[model samples]
Target chain A: MNLKRLESILDDLEGFSDPNIRYEQYVTPSYVAARMLHTISLSNHIEGKMIVDLGTGPGILAIGSALLGAHYVVGVDIDSSVFQIALSNLADLDELFVGQPPIDFVESDVTKCVLKPKSFDVAIFNPPFGTKGNSGIDVSFIKAALDLTKVAVYSLHKSSTRSFIVKKGEQLGAKVEVLGQFSYDLPATYARHSKAVKAIDVDLLRFSHR
Target chain B: MKLLTHNMLTSRCLKGVTNGYPLKIVANEVKTENVDYNSEFIARVIPKVDWKVLSSTASDFGVSLPEEPPADIESNEDMLRKVHHALLEIEITQGDLICPETGRKFPIKQGIPNMLCNEDEVK
Candidate 1:
């Protein structure tokens, strides 16, 4: 599907009703998700690829990848409730899932789960930004995603952390590149945010293992 | 979860557990949904799956596979279909993925396997 079609399909997906602050559970906008997947597809990785989404809140990335022709997709998250929502969201788009396997939503923490290493072709997620009480959680998610895939990993992060993430990914033996930038619209979901909507500098990143 | 996923899952990192592979399944509900048969995808994924674990686990559900993957799987359509079904079609809707070494059960409810453990369970 094209970018406009992909974004429209993704816009219909349900978001977290009570997003956990600890996980930095923010709904990735459909426009951004569509853009990210489109970029990955340009690299010729989405079609016929085994894709995994770590911390897959509401299954947007996983579903988007499948919609883009990923062969088999797995969506992993620690939250148990999201899968129920994800399944229902998937069922809403029954026509789209005609050929694909229903996402295997494994309920597990990304850092700890010994998910088959170097097995999947690609990994994708909007990992916890590692804020609040959870420090370094973004790096943890990046590391976990890297372990699962042989080809590449895709994610979004704060533009401020580019240097740090670039260094960290290289230390882990992957070539990291910044793909694009956006103003991540974080609708105030928690008690702490004083604004109705908060927009933050966001950078889309790609890490590849050749 | 599909066998394609179970083929990769292991609670081996759980504290004090050894050989936590091929998690034993205790199925309360097993659901089979028909999916498209894609031979090329199945052929590509075959080498990544452990035949022993997949075949033995599939046998428990009465879908018997051969003792080993065929010599030339890319050319064998029937074998590819069977693996595709077992890997993508069959699911444990409500079950427990018990770690083999410790018998620690990670409950699978609503067709999703929750692998998170209690505080003391983490190393």
Candidate 2:
């Protein structure tokens, strides 16, 4: 509730870690994650409904959803290390909700993970677009993401890949809408030289399942 | 650039290289400044890094590092110090990042990458 206490809670959450993990990447920037939650609440006034974050690295969106009043949230990813981070972050959010939604972090490929079909009211994901010098954009991940919710929002790279995802979503029978876009000037490490100096256009897209 | 973007980039723009699988680096502006280093953050992030790409890129910038880092490194002050430097110290302010494929130039002005493609490229 207080500023100092909130900062300490975040420090503890940020301090959490794990090894031997894969695919749990990109702790969605909190401001962006918060914005995503805002967009969902604005698009449809569905309060206290079940929500899920498919690739919930560090559980920022999942925890933000809980803080924003999602009755329940399931944050899924293939990496356990990221789950650990998410687990800690969600702890700080417990105080915000009165009988809040249980935020569960499952370590599994979202595509193979089982869900309450058509049960989730909203699903949000900031999937791993690129990894280890490789890009992981594909139809299967999108299909899997769409299968679990009535409406889904995605934070995606603004590239030619956007066209591919839109086409795929429409074929699967959801009205696709791009919500908003922003750019990030990511710093570079010694290992990665490109310095992600480009304006990484982050798009918020909605798949309105009719 | 963020590890997320580097992971998806290809060097298809390099002339005479068919796949251009990895783009080579020619960094003009490299600064090591204000980025913060949370050990927990680095520990969580190690798994996501493309070491091969990272090492090679670092090498281009004249920073030599091992391909496989030792475990239990947190206790090693020297190693942790180096990791800290590598992860958060460097900044890229002005330069041209070439797309390995298509040789598209994404310029970095004041540390911002302009990835805008022309109308023809967009179509």
**Over 4 Å off, model 1:** A189-193
TM-score, prediction 1: 0.96
Lowest summed lDDT over 10 consecutive residues: which window, candidate 1 chain B? B33-42
**Which 10-residue span in candidate 2 chain B carries the lowest summed lDDT?**
B1-10
Candidate 1 per-residue lDDT over residues B21-82, each given as its tens digit: 98989999998888777788779888888999999988888789998987987999888888
What DockQ does each listed candidate score?
0.73, 0.01
What value does the lDDT take at residue B82 in candidate 2?
Answer: 62
Native-to-model Cα distance after best TM-score fit, residue A26 in candidate 2, in Å: 1.9
Looking at model 1, give its docking quality level.
Answer: medium
Q: Write the per-residue lDDT of candidate 1 for residues A127-168, one digit (tens) a residue.
A: 877767787998998998888899999999889899999999
